[model samples]
Target: MTTAPTPVPTPAATELSGGAGASGTATPVPRRRTVKLRGGSWLATVPLFAFFAISFGLPAIAIAIGAFTLSSDAETGAGTFTTQNVTDSVQGAYWTSLLSSVKLSALTALIGTVLGLPIAQAVVTSRFRAVREAVLSASGVLANFGGLPLAFAFVATLGNAGEITKLFHLTDHGWSLYSFTGLTIVYLYFLVPLMVLSITPALDGLRVQWREAAHNNRATTLQYWRHVALPILFPSLLGGYVLLFGSAFAAYATAAAMVGATVPLISRSIADALSGNVLVGQGNLALALSLDMIVVAVVVMAVYLPLQRRSARWLS
Candidate 1:
């Protein structure tokens, strides 16, 4: 039997192993020193960190400080501090406005979640790519389409004397577009689309193999979703709800333009306070109101971050 030729070591392997040289002795070869990156790659994020400090951190600090400072002190740089502004913020008309904003945000978020989830699922499951593309594209546009133009469009189409109302006798049935319910409807216009964009990726992340396994186990469609899909998607759904809540909570221009003082949203109150509509020095009250808003947002973020981490862990 012919013996197999001895395997030859590659040049790289020879160098690494200190292979025999012409002297018939092992010659040690120095291993190349790898340039260890000492966290310099993190320097790339400096600009982003600086931007947040300037735009977000600094402003947030200013808001916290201004919330405690008296209006007179604010003007004179005295830095005199008190809790009266914060206390006053949650009382009387300010309290009423804060409650109203919370109610509106909760209502819109609930309705948006319920409606948007199915629409997003349908788009993701559909075989018609063109239709899905069209819907997603429209959703992207409508999610950002708000403020003055949206208010104008809705007013022109659904307001009491608007042509659609005139055509359908909507006002005859008490379908006024200037009321709280009307505002909810208008807010849902953008919020539902925003939900679509937010949750579609999560729905898509549902692996086909999951469904196949469920089917193999004789799980009904509802059973599969209940036992498999919904649980996995719960975190993402909650995150979307929180996002929608914040969007509605912080909305200013649309409510300001459409409903004016009638809605009693906190954002409207902020505008009134800041513009000296309440009183010249009530700008301090605006800062207090802003502090209340910041607290609510912080709480919402606290809830959202935990859910987000859970979602990433399970989905990935």
Candidate 2:
């Protein structure tokens, strides 16, 4: 036989040697190299990161620290850690203001959801592109149309000497611009449009195929909505409600300008505390109130995120 029989390579040997041929000389495999970011690449984000740190992060840190600390004396400028500010924030008039804020936020969120859902649905299902565009454009503008200008606009329309008040003789009918009812009306001006903008996408995500499938399966319109549509829409509806609640709860300038501290809102209370109108040496108490609002807002967002995630599962 002269030459030795050529050895057969095993599959494992071939794989390990990078599929080397029968010659037995192994081929080198090239390793994947990770691409690292260049110094210039990171520079682009520095400005944005710095802006957030200065504007939001620093202020938030100050509020958190100040909430739990009290000055020993104005002259000494020494702060000692304490929870009395938190305690005081939840008692007496502060408690009442907190309750009023909760009630107002809840009421406005409910009303906005109820009124806006139908409008969102109508706009989403509309055949005309112009109609949808107009509605959406209007909603976008109105949703952001709040603060002092919004308050002033409502005042010009519903105040004591307002045109509607004079025309309908509302003052004689016992309507007051500075009352809770009036505040609710003013809130609705923005709340309804916000809800519309929020829920429109959710409504648009409802596929026509779902309704067709339901109809094909001999399902009634009510049954399809009750079983399929509602379940899918529930998460979105709840998310929108929580978002609206947080927004209304944190509102300051509109309520402050419209009704002053007459409505006893948490925002107004915080303002009073900071300005020394409510009590002297109560700046820490204002920070505590702010912390409470932050906590409530955090809770609302926590609830909203999960609901939004669940809704996205179906819609996506």
Candidate 3:
């Protein structure tokens, strides 16, 4: 009994042996795999990038290249480098069309903002959730409710043979649905809704505390809006104006189906040129007009970006 006792393995030696086993054999440890996380992040965006390239980037490149090139002959269909298309786009009737487009866009944007702001404000402050939901739903539908069907609907509602026109005729009044004014009226149908959609979030972003503070200072409702609210909302308002302007400017189907080519909008002119209805060698001119539109859009976006950023600072 006093003989030397058998040495027992320490806990550290047992752990190193991967726990005690009846056979006293160590279990093999599996090697850990290190996953690389860097390269795969961009994989998700590949589809999006491809889509953008095919849809927008390729077409834009073709338009730019075509704008600077002239057809050598109608039969040969060969292109030669030239800048005459660009010059032609900015001169004569084409220039007038551009100006007309600009004017129409500006007018629509202004009118839409003025009419939409109140509707948005009302919706934001409404006591009824159902009313707010209805307004927003209608605004969403009407905002995008454009194109040929929209034009047809307007024509049926306001054209010479339209109900409104007949009603006005009954009252011994005249109404024209083919004029610039008439086009503007048709444009308002979609434009006002677009404005409502655009400004609603901005209006909602207005904090209640600001209003309470204004009231605490004994400020009237008009005074509060004029000073505190207007200043905060101005950036969003301007951004919405730019968005509406772009919408009206880029509109083609609605105007084309509604008034034909009677209105000399830039988009209509571009269509005419591309359809070969204007003149020979005018295809490049169509691209030039498109380029002009792109430039105008770019400028509009440049202005909009800053205003949108400023608005986000408060709204967010």
Candidate 4:
């Protein structure tokens, strides 16, 4: 008698259905798992978002709300909303203080931009990697090495009784480290380094091919810079200027430690208002001053962001 032959199963069929075991019992087939990718929608960012909301969003909103609200007794919290505080902030002494901060910030920002651009260019063009590394390292350090320590260092190095002051007889020459000029000079110590750090990438973005092409056109160095480099670099330059301006405008500790109330900075004025050094129950005024600062900061960011995006296209 002819026995019925069992047909061999194909690999696909064996995989889909279970394969036979050595004992001739069919094995269980493995199921396929579908993976879901967790993009930004995951809960991992919740903590960070919550922290930011608490730390910055809350405080900024409070400041904005408080700016329009009048101050009441210490226990009563805020009073009715009014524009008095806002108006007061832009008038008289507060106005002067704001203008003073702007002048100082602009002066230092321009000076830092001018001084730093060449230094950045030199570093980018340098053949020695060590030179570039050292310069960039120094810049990073100096840019961050500000506030009280920087103030004290400048005082000890250039103050009335300082070693350099005595060596150069600067006091006799009326070079007061407690004045506007001295404050500016001290600001430059950090500002220039900041400029170098900010503009180095933009300078590096200046391709060698641009220079070669300029040379091919028989352009001189000055002509190349005027026609090719400066035009391209202008946005980055303006962006750096705005950056330096913001840095100087917001600086408080250094100016306070060095020049005190003589400079009339907006930050100092705001501090004075908060501390009741000017008047009691002036928290409303402090809030207003803070609001003014916020406005200025908003304007700076508005200008900076666009320029930064534009520069990135050419430089990046």
RMSD to the true structure for each prediction, in A, is 3.7, 5.9, 6.2, 6.2
Q: Per-residue lDDT for 11 in model 3?
A: 81
Cα lDDT computed for each candidate against the true fold: 0.92, 0.91, 0.90, 0.91
lDDT of 4 by residue, 62-129 (tens): 89888899867578684988999999999999999999998999999999999999999999989999
Candidate 3 accuracy as TM-score: 0.84
Candidate 2: worst-modelled 10 consecutive residues by lDDT:
21-30
Please list the residue runs of candidate 2 whose C-alpha ends up more than 4 Å from where it truly belongs after superposition.
Answer: 1-53
What lDDT tens digits, residue by residue, belong to model 3 across residues 145-234? Answer: 999999899788888788877876823554678879989988889989899998888898999999999999999999999999999999
- Can you give the lDDT of residue 89 in candidate 2? 89
Report the Cα lDDT for candidate 3.
Answer: 0.90
Please provide, for model 1 over 1-316, each residue's C-alpha lDDT reduced to its tens digit, 9 standing for 90 to 100.
8998987889987877788776779986668998968788888899999999999999999888889987555556665688999999999999999999999999999999999999999999999999899999999999999999999999999998788999999988989888899999999999999999999999988999999999999999999999999999999999999989999999988998899988899999998888888787777779999999999988988988887888888788
Highest-scoring model, TM-score: 1
| TM per prediction | 0.91, 0.84, 0.84, 0.84
Off by over 4 Å in 3: 1-41, 170-174
Return the lDDT, model 4, position 98: 94
